[model samples]
Target: MSEINPSQITFARVRRRLTKAQLAKELGVTSRSIQNYETGSSAPDSETLAKMAKLLNFPQQFFCIEESMPVIGEHAASFRSLSKMSDAMKNCALSAGAIAFHINDWIEERFNLPQADLPDLSDLPPEEAAATLRRMWGLGSAPIPNMIQLLESKGIRVFSLAEEAREVDAFCTWHGSKPFVFLNTMKSAERSRFDAAHELGHLVRDVYSMRHGETRGIEMEREADAFAGAFLMPSESVVANKPPAFTIKYLLKLKHYWGVSLAALAYRFNALGQVTEWGYRNLCIEIAKAGYRTNEPEPMEREVSQLLNKVLDALQAQKVGRAEIARGLCISVDEINALTFKLTRLSVVPADSSIDLVSRRSPGLRLV
Candidate 1:
């Protein structure tokens, strides 16, 4: 076991959104002492380490583990509603993602996860990029049956944001060679689908550009929104399916076929010139009046993570469960659930259940 690193204390405190003063109060220490510990001028005693671990809900061993991977930089992550989010909240979310990367590394060692198979279309226009990805993925003009599954199949790791901030719709970043897209699943399914596609746009276009020192501003956001609209409802399909006259009623009815929000469909129509400027203006007004802007009508079912479900199933077969995994990683089961899209089963097993026994004591455990 390694000695406890002072930096790990700072990382954990920051991840929990606790100020140094706040953590010091919780740990019954002076703020300056917390600072000293964080800055490596002092180290926590064993009793202090126990108190810190219990307070943070992290295993004591976690503080001793070397920090192998750094949290992704803010510039590298493409955040939706970036302006509305507090810096602390953003850090909390990103720290969660960093923990997820650690969990993913553990899983990858056990399971043969899919490899990323996406083209770099950083130079192409958003519309062309969407169309190109569609062709590349063999999606053509068909509506994606399951966006999460499609992404998982292509090896883009998708995680649900447990950050209680509603303003943060979604974000995407490329960690090492793999792409990670985090979605705010609290939104309606329609909006979540759009968010996934929008982040995909960032992953495909903005991530590479940002690495090359390209400045992403409002123009990038607009491009991502446009890409999402085009990707979810392809121009060819929209052209074929759109009515002669575009209206909120027509869009509401047509949205199910495209599996997008009515607002998204209307905006796509306006962009494609299928709806006149006057018609689009009235359509937007009508949509907002009907509360379609904030809430989607007839929302599709939420897309669950297919890859996570399979991984859990495989682990179950090997007599491994959430508690075991969490204990092994020196994290909480709640953290595991957050990283795995809340797919981890939480129900208590019967005392007499054989499955519980198997989970508690499994011999020769290996991933199939």
Candidate 2:
């Protein structure tokens, strides 16, 4: 009975990663028509609205919801490979961020989540900033067992990047005072951990620097990369535990110890002058030859959200299943799962059919 909200058309389209022309073709209409529908100059009739909802995989009521879609502007977010990513990829990731805001809000309203405890470390160099954070958190050159858990404990909201945004390694942004990180779970577990740390670097450095009129692009990215390397593999630990040789086997052992990719370890070692430039290049070549660049060897288990797990368990205890949550948001259960790290385990019966919940936790996957 509600009138269609034109902006919702755009939100659904972007969330699905479809451009106006592509969606128009699917709907057997002109791109101009789709634009008009999105801009509120005109509205899609019931039939067209139904098709749009179906193609976008959103419920029909979603397009009629009165609430505004939360927007994270391009300038506000720190995206990995921002220059190389297509507009669709960036928008898709940003849309996922909007969904994350909704889910985070829903959780916060009912429970007392951790408050942000991050300090401003923009004035210091990346290594010093990393060390300062380590000292502040009482982590002295020790390897982090779980980056996601640690970040959540510090009141950072972490979510998984859907498969549609796989090209985007990860991204972070501030929604008001709170920080949110989106990690590409499709990547190897080691790479994902680095991504998590990389975003944390942005939270500590880039977010504060931006307020003081600093540019928010590749320069910040370079600094964040350095921070992540130092945060994950402390310089003192790396120097004290320098290997006798930098062979692939030795690199593999170190990779497991540090819980980072081989290339990351190689770069860190080379940066510290332990390996010559020529030696670094050769190590990279050997790593590529072993297909380590594309495929990870001896992967650790993927880290998920401990906070979200607890939240879901609490919700289950209250007899509020995922279906109720999805209905409250006027979205599909699958959409909720996509925004989450896919961690909800209670059985849910969607409007269309039933979905069996199963554990996605990787078993017996230890650092080898």
Candidate 3:
């Protein structure tokens, strides 16, 4: 350990949000001395370090001691927001970080790896394009069990985008050959699942296009939607079940069957000549009037993403105590309680247990 220099004292003082004059008033020293201290023209004595620590409420060692810090990077708060996130919330979006970090690492590792020659989808017919993807991925069946997990295990990054990206429900970006898909999490699981399928469509079909997120031509969106519908529900199954006109009841039945929005299946019905274009439009208007667009009429099914499940398993595998994890990850005390609360629902910790844990503060948290 070394003596406290003026810079260290001044840095800590500013971080504590104390001004030079204010610190001087508290320390009973002149403002000039504080300024000189910050400029490294002067230093605080050991006794003064104690006083500063008492004021700042940070470990005295925080001044010069170094420790390994976790990588807390930011992601787009939303597709619309320009500002990046702060270093905080790395723990909150643990699954996102874990998968994204691995995906990014894989790209860096394979930067020089030759991209496997993919089909030139630009010239292929839409059916051929879809078929090409089907062959490439070997998705030989009708109904995908859980779409999110399916894409993630294939090296695609899927995040449920925030509510603001409702209009723009999903997107795809490629780091080399790997696709990063963001599904709007704020949406229903049905929609999120479809969005994942749709983004996969974009990744498979539109990989050659230089423009990524900002490229919003009708052609691209249409192709992706087609891909989503066919990929999730498949073409022949839909065609096999065609009706003259799709009613609200019919659409509702399939919503549970395929986990897709009513409007999406309605369009499919119209496209397959199950209903006239006018009938399809009227059905949508009727559904909107009934508030089916805003809320599920029946109880919606819940699906915990595989990504979140993996994180839970990882924690349990490490045998980390809840409180230790909370503090180590810089999360709220309540977060640990809430996570452990499920398993420890009936298990109660005494009031003293809380005090015992809190008393053992992080080294950075101690003032002295």
Candidate 4:
């Protein structure tokens, strides 16, 4: 009904790392036209707008929003690293493990967030540890729907941290009592969801596992993963009567709700004593052969995180847009959009390495 904001479209496309030249060719426009649109001196016709939306895989309305925010949080430090790193490697690294983020000191710098003076979670048994966390956050017995939002709600400062550290296999690590969960942003919503839960394992279970700079151990990772499994799918609710035959269709149906890898679900079933070890192994081979692992998985956080929804809802309710929030913080709009709203409300170290200021509420707020 209204004209699109060309600048917003260009920003979103570039944030996705789609080049102007790439989109121009796909949309049958000259690169110079794309440039003009990005600078906001000119606009696209309806015909061009349809093509742009199709090529970018975005709704045309997405470009009509006045303010555009970076989907992931970015800092000057992160942007500098991105310029130096290969995108392909970044993709692989994020999809891989915890080893990737260390390439640019994201871990080191993120651990330095002002509120990260982690309380000691050591010497407590698993049950006691989880309970202490619940008590601290005032959580009920019900599972946390969104791991990222849940962590952010509790002031844990969850971030995607999928910067180009290509060598990493999918793993999470804690820095100075601050926990970071890196999900390969490129992975399907399914894989990303499980990765989020897996990282949640590291956060909730490993509060006390650190000593003298030791990283998360394999056994510790496993126990946290188990917690994530039970927490996410709720083994009691999902476990079938008469062991509803484990077929590919059955697994797909399970994945629809669980957002866990078939392999992980396969393992969970074995743990529940629903399937034999041999059946589990065979199922794994079958699922793998069927191209389940390589195919992108769904994201659980989109469905689960009440934290994220609440933040967006609260902001929408307040009519507090991203630009106003960023202007209030005197930081990039990208930071506010990338992380959950609670993280912003909490005092965080500002992105400016050049300026070190206290993290507190600003006295005056509202966009000019």
Highest-lDDT candidate: 2
Model 3 C-alpha lDDT per residue in residues 1-368, reported as the tens digit of each score? 46544444644454344678999999888999888777767777777766876786434664443322222223222122113422222223332333344333422332221223334465664556766666676877456767766665565544443222233444555544545565555557676677777766666666556233344456766777787777776567777766544788877877677678787788776765668778878998998999978775663454444543443343344443444334433333343332222122222222222223223322211100
**Candidate ordering by lDDT (highest first):** 2, 1, 3, 4
Ranking by TM-score: 2, 1, 3, 4
1-368 per-residue lDDT for model 1 (tens digits): 45777777877887788999999999999999999988889888989989999998788888887763366777878887777889888888888888888778777767778888778888899999999999987888988888888888888889888654345788887778888988887788888899999988988877566565455688899999999999998998898887967776667778888889888898898899887899889889888999988888888777777777777776776566777777667777777766555433443222232333322432222212
lDDT by residue for model 4 (286-352), tens:
8788777787344243433343344434444445454544443323444443333222343333333
In candidate 4, stretches whose alpha carbon ends up further than 4 angstroms from where it belongs are 1-144, 166-180, 240-243, 296-368
lDDT of 1 at 335: 76
TM-score of 4: 0.49
The CA lDDT at 25 in model 4 is: 82
Q: Each candidate's TM vs. the true structure?
A: 0.90, 0.91, 0.56, 0.49
Better of 2 and 3 by lDDT: 2
lDDT of 2 by residue, 121-231 (tens): 878899999999999999999899999889988889898887788788898887777889998888888998998898999889776554443458677789889999999
In model 1, which runs have C-alpha deviations exceeding 4 angstroms? 164-166, 210-215, 342-368
Q: lDDT of all the models against the reference?
A: 0.79, 0.82, 0.53, 0.51
The lowest-lDDT stretch of 10 consecutive residues in candidate 3 is 359-368
